[model samples]
Target: MKSNNEKNPGISRRTFLYSLGALALSGCDGGISAPVTPGSRATSRVSTSGITLAHVANGAADVATSGAFAHPGLLHTQADFDRMAQKVAAQASPWYDCWNVLIANSHARLSWSPRPQVEVDRGGSGAQNYPVLYGDIAAAYASALRWKITGDTAYADKAVQIMNAWSSTLQILGGDSNVDLAAGIYGYEFANAGEIMRGYSGWAAADFAAFQTMMRDIFYPINVDFLNRHNNTDITHYWANWDLCNMASIMAIGVLCDDHTLFDQAVNYYIDGAGNGAIAQAVYYMHPGYLGQWQETGRDQGHNTLGIALGGAICEMAWNQGIDLYGYDNNRFLAGAEYVAKSNLVQADGTYLTVPYVSYTNVDVTQPGFSTASQGTIRPCWALVYNHYVNRKGLAAPWSTKFALAIQPEGGGGNYGTASGGFDQLGYGTLTCTRDAVTPATAPSGLTAFPSAGQVVLSWWGVAGGTSYNVKRASSSGGSYTTVASGIADPLTYTDNPSAGTWYYVVSAQTATGESSNSAEVVAVTALQLHTYLTFDEASGTSAADATGNGHTGTLIGGATRAAGHSRNAVSLDGSSGYVSLPGNVVADISDFTIAAWVFWNGGNAWARIFDFGAGTGRYLFLTPKSSSGLMRFAITTNGGHGERAINGNVALPTGQWAHVAVTLSGTTATLYLNGNVIGGSTDMVFAPWRVGPAAQNWIGRSQYSGDPYFHGSIDDFRIYRGAMSTDQITALVQGS
Candidate 1:
């Protein structure tokens, strides 16, 4: 963060900080990568022309609040328990043995007892009763998992009893500075145990509420304080594991207590917090072969391995609640996990293998090389992470898989040892994280088919042990299919020139054994040509050429000049006089249309049009990054602003980043989308584009209102489709098609 990103020149130090400094990851529940949600960040700066601009943030950051959280969403969710119960009941090998380990443990037995203290301290000069607290935490969590798997009231009663003892007796959790660790680590653990048992009828309503209160009152304060202040030291002084545990506690407790504020807080901190736990900071540097160097790699292997435990916990929690932090920052955590796993693994000859390393440093200290102290460290945290990427997402995780197998049939809390690190993560992956049964043998997965202006593009995650892929296509949903392409090897992708019709596609993997079954299906409809396509790739021209065969080429009017675009060259507008003028009546007659473009918002005045097509203010269809009401507005008016039909995004367009903005009109329903997620829509509209008559002043960046200011940033790949596309197609547009 202190230096420019020389590797990815697209993300300069300033631009990256501006883009992701305050943003959170946003996308569908299980997307390949987490895209951005425009945030409402405003900062003032003087422009080159001496204009003082209050630059608002655009794309490259946060999702809106979840509005709601799924119940029992923490380290484990309902689905994970269900999977465990089913596998164990069927006497499955790994899960059944894993269950045996759980039932055999003293903490999981009905004979377990609670040990609580009014003040538990971990540092010097105080009652060091924190171990007692960690012990009770283990008992409570183990009993809760047993109850979940067996549907036994006895285990639930025991879990509730342990929790009640802690909540009723614990009032003050104080220590020298290490209390933060006690608070963060046990705070998240206790909350997860409480979360698992929240649904138990044996645990009465009042007692459960008291447990919630204990987590909120007794634990949350320290967790938030540590994250916010970092023990009053340099922000980078604390290790990544410290910030991670606190983040996990905040996120888990938020879900347990049903608080979106806490949930968003943890998520925002993970993505944008100026701490060691943030993605870019946690995985500080990328090395060769997709390995990302963990921030604590130089400190010690014991602490370095703890990062995987905490990060996996955070990612799993977010994934269960319909977010994709697992793939956040293009899977930086996976890369770091691979690096850590390779560095800490044994190489069959009773010797630790050496791995690549990049010297990591911060304000507090510097480590010029990797540390060999406790080098062969192994943690039970690998299974959950390995299963997610390989079995769940069909991506390779070689070292992650190796380490998980090394620690197979993982038991929670007490199985590793008596140390605090053993209890730091909620283990038991052979039972909860194993997905070998349903792992596809023949089928490739994560199939995506995107319909573009003239063609359809297809891609998928590779099947394990597969050598090649066969791309199959059909005219209808359930084939009757034929091979469009076969024997695709590396870089698993395919493009097809289908005729003007709807097409269904799937991919099958060619394993050494044989050709496997087909993957999940995807569809594409390629009918309409790009009505008015603006490439804006003319680097030095005043004419913004139209790439569509149609002759709706645009002219760079005022002072608009060619600048760096989202994908290629773009048109840069100077906020006042700069704008693009297209031929008259560009989209004046289309009934169903889709308009999509990539925008770089420089925080201009309100009502600056990304595009406006109309003869006058009374009859126009325009999309504005920010409206007078401080929201992104897409309005179509035949009778003026007051009488216009409009759809507004939840927030204004963020400034200083490239955001994919799109609007689709299907029948009377006009929807507005940012990135890939739908932000707003209007369903009662009756007017169509033809109703606006012959639009004479079809313009980009200039609004219909004479008083409105011109757009202040850049626009690229502006396109108009003759028909409104589906959500999947809009998502494809987000992928830069």
Candidate 2:
């Protein structure tokens, strides 16, 4: 096993000395490594006494000395240590020292910029220098662990030097200065630094205690002050790219200090829209390479994974401290791990595949792809490691093992090889496993003889050693097909929900080696209508029974002459009845359905029922009448409830002139068109086939059940369709010459 200290060469004595000199020169103004006097104030100090540093150190030392272990603090037995040491010894080289350089540079920056008042871009524009405070803290702790394991005074001295620098320079600013100090609380940059420092405190109890006091008194309070002020506010714009970093850092610090106020505030910010509402929001707000931007770019999976991984790490740290992150519950994190493992990792059979992104067409399944050689191969490996801890600690889920297997690298060649150099040394290993030839299967036979309802089942044969399957469907021959379901390992079958119409299905099988072969195609039929149609006829009915009752059954009373009625109730062309009761009782069974009515009224009233079911539950299509315009109004009740749509102007009803009105419901959207022009539209909950009949009748002139106002206008021809008509279709119907 490679020891963290030994594997990272940047931690050499020379580098340590250089970092110390940098810290000393940066400012000895009671900032870096200044010994604390009894009366001196402390701020942003981190203590390590409570952490299990000894165990961590022993674990690290065990790996370094043995050289055969794979990870530090993971091996349970001495034998396991011996086995991992061999692997490390064979792979160890000077290049491993780069990690140390990173550590040193990171520490030096942390120590000098304890509270960075200004940004420093190290050679690049917009790139801020490492916030060395946390880096120094991490270095000190890592060095202390190294010292405990190897009894190396060099490591101990380095740790002491870093700690002393932090003790003196750590400043707790209040009042106006609090702003400057609080700016340093950028979470991503500082939380890891604090964790590192805290890790080191394990070596010396008194120093750790002092560090804890400094963190509690200085660092934590400033963070609390800033967060309290910005809580539930849109101040995310102020921090710009580092918003998540800042938020996560605050939460981590709050957890460290056990400050419920800050912690709860952060949690509410994330889960309750105070923080970035979704990962996408974070990505959208930041520039590329910024904390959120890296994930958003999507080109470099490694970098994107790092952002998510850091989030996971911080989540774990918070969880360990008893903080509840809203969306990142153990199950969700475990689910993410499962996704990465099953989709992205190279399997043991030498085939690499993973779900790199979510498919826009199908939000459920992750799109799979083979990894490129240029990217860092360690990402999935790291995810696996973190997931392992979560699983082993019983903190995540039992499915973690399954997820781990999905991402575990295949043991043979072409995999990530053990090497000891920089960039060039990171290429793929020798190819040991031969790539399998993939051939697309013929379209499935017996497609025309499928079921008409329930689950649409599709099946195929001939795929051997297959690990999973993907299913695609299209409406017409040679049309575009989309993946509807995936990741099925057995039974060689899939069942799709029945819809109204004929549909086609196709299946593809993926091998354990990551090769995929498409299967033959199949088609199924459904009873539900897939389209809606509409038309308006000026003459139809007058009273509740006449408007909804089939054609001749409707009452032809008074000025409700079909021609006169054309300006009001429109017409019910289909044999289906159109009924209107007082208060508003009306219903219609619509697959893809359209409602056209001519209404004429000029009055201000509440609960003006344009159309609704007698029961007043489930779906409702109604209108809200405004004092300004007797123009027109509409609403839809899908999913479970209802909402309204009202027109902008008050075009007085042309007394006797016929006017057209139509509402169309298709898929999950409902649109209201007046005289062929789109007036309003809204997204419905989901698509459901509604049933309308005598009890569930359609109201034409007034609302029957509840009283507010009744329609006083002519009636006309009303037509309903089995499908939703397009705007063009609706326009033609409303404007027929």
Candidates' C-alpha lDDT:
0.74, 0.36
- TM per prediction: 0.58, 0.40
Score residue 527 of candidate 1 by CA lDDT: 66
In angstroms, the error of model 2 at 396 is: 16
lDDT of 2 by residue, 1-737 (tens): 11101111224322322232232122111101110001000112222222222221111111011111111111112232242233234433221222233224333222332233222221223433433443444455445433433445666567666655555455533323223223333333333333443434333766655544555666555454443443333333222122333445555655544454444444333321222222322332111001112222233344334344444544444443333231221122333333333333455686654332311111111222333433333432232333333322312222224433333331111122231221111111111101122332322211111221234444433233355667787776444778888886533456677455656666665654564544334444444232212223323335333233333133322333333344333433111222333221112223345666554443344444444442233234555433224555554432112112223323333333456667665545667776777876666323323211112233444453354454444445545444456799888877662
Best by TM-score: 1
RMSD of each: 16.4, 20.1
Assess candidate 1 and give its TM-score to the true structure.
0.58
For residue 732, give model 2's deviation from the true position in Å.
15
Candidate topping lDDT: 1
Worst 10 residues of 2 by lDDT: 31-40
Q: Write the per-residue lDDT of candidate 1 for residues 328-435, one digit (tens) a residue.
A: 654668878988988888888988777767455555456778999778777778888888888877665667878888877777765753122467766777787888
